[model samples]
Target: MSDLPPNHHADLRHSGPSGYISGLTMIVGRGNDARLVADLADLQPGDHVLDIGCGPGTAVRNAARAGIRVTGIDPSEPMLREARLLTRLRRPAGEVEWAQAGVEDLPLPDASVRVCWSLASVHHWPDLEAGLTEVRRVMTAGGVFLALERRSPVGATGTASHGWTADQAAAFAHMLTEHGFVSTDVSNHDMGRRKVVVVTGRT
Candidate 1:
């Protein structure tokens, strides 16, 4: 058995019409995480970014607005539809595309992306190892990968327990290092009504 920590919400698959509602609600209170991810990426104008589990394309569009090529992929059709509609209506300049995919399977060429990020989504991955291997495969030499989760209180329950505690963040950082990522780090930040932990590493 793998020694990795459990994915807190492995069975949570946001799909179907209810996913639309999730997407709409997702638009709220996520700007901080999205903007923070984009900032942490240190993106160049023409760089390519892949956002795994990119619900509603919030982070995708945030990166795209900086004149970069960005693809937002999610497993849910309804979420992708909502993302597409939102993108078309509030179009940000630069290349923006949406794909229906999950973390375990990415539809991009090998070593084709400079940055890969998952915001508030990694915990939902059914298989973290496969997801990380796929991420490492698609990233170019010297690429960056980041995963951000809300910093939840220990022993919390229900919706409040959806995020990671400090220990969980550290565990994720260690896993990142084990996956051949260099300079892995974990940090805590206060993002306005939500405290979050971010794990970053360079490949």
Candidate 2:
């Protein structure tokens, strides 16, 4: 009934409750295996973080371990429930805030956060521009935004079964630059059998 395509629902619910544990385990698992620390960049102690599309609070936990206040926003109630549980398990009672909201409709106040990190969720974004603008509005003047997304197929390893293309990554880079993030940088490389682009910018 929704005018959106069939994949729209799946994509829209990318961070939803169903299979959320597996999803978080897969991506954050990879980050952890590689010892991939966050791109805190210039963030200082006491800075607030907004983890868009935060799946199961991995990034939220990571930021909190660094002494930062973290707020995670996702469209899935199920995912938020897990986030809440994780926060309570590992952090103090009020250490983190988990909100059920989409990237294009974050519930936090404007300029309320010092950093925003979105990982492995860009391809699912319905309106990339609106999502980027929403992130920009919520970031402080010197805040940082780091987005890590899957890139086009460079070889057999980089190729998704659906055959992702480089053109998609390029379009996303243009979108990021147009939304006022300075020093936008996009990099692509082989991650085992997949290509990934790490996009970093400053608000």
Candidate 3:
């Protein structure tokens, strides 16, 4: 875990109209991206998956459709509320639980998760290293971790502040390797209208 200060917690919260905009983005704009993460996770039936920085639970709902149980964790109460509402409306096949938490502080037991997915959310993490450590701690041996973030010049959002460059993606992949993750791969993917940097690692 990183020894850095924790001031980013305030930046993590999504409230007011921005929260609703984020929710709408997850629901309508990022469904394919969520499915890509779910596919990359290679979930097994009854597997317990964790969605860190899960905004509005879009990825949670997507993964649950494959019959894997999911827990969606985020620091934003408004996001969690939207997630719960969406879950009720979608009624995915697998069970989903929502938690008000953050990547630096996962509210789960060690080695409890079979897979972890974080989509378009890593930039908001308070401390990337600490968050990855927490993710590793919560995941079982050989568990998969898939994270996707928009690249700069994002065609859809045009939000560069939360986006990464190719070099940054490579650096993040190296960090994963240093943290004891094996078979780490980082690459850019064309997700229809937008480009994304995808990082996959295993514990």
* Highest lDDT scorer: 1
> 1-203, model 3: which lDDT tens digit per residue?
32222122226557787887877777788888887887777788879998887888888988888777999998888788899998898899998998998888999999999899888887677788888889888989989998798776423233544666666566678888888787798878887887888989988
Pairs that collide in candidate 3 are none
Candidate 3 deviant stretches above 4 angstroms? 1-12, 153-158
TM per model?
0.95, 0.77, 0.88
> Which runs in model 1 stand beyond 4 Å of their true positions?
1-6
Give one digit per residue, the lDDT tens place, for model 2 in 84-200: 776677884325878888888889889998778776666566667678889999989977887766554434231141222455555556677789977676666565765566667
C-alpha local distance difference test of each model: 0.87, 0.65, 0.79
Between prediction 1 and prediction 2, the one with superior TM-score is: 1
Show model 2 residue runs off by greater than 4 Å. 1-30, 33-37, 40-42, 92-94, 152-165, 189-195
Least accurate 10 contiguous residues by lDDT in model 1: 1-10
What's the true lDDT of residue 116 in model 1?
Answer: 94
lDDT of 1 by residue, 118-143 (tens): 98888888998999889988999899
The local lDDT score (0 to 100) that residue 156 gets in candidate 2 is 25
- Error (Å) of candidate 1 at residue 147 is 0.3
- TM-score of candidate 1 against the unseen true structure: 0.95
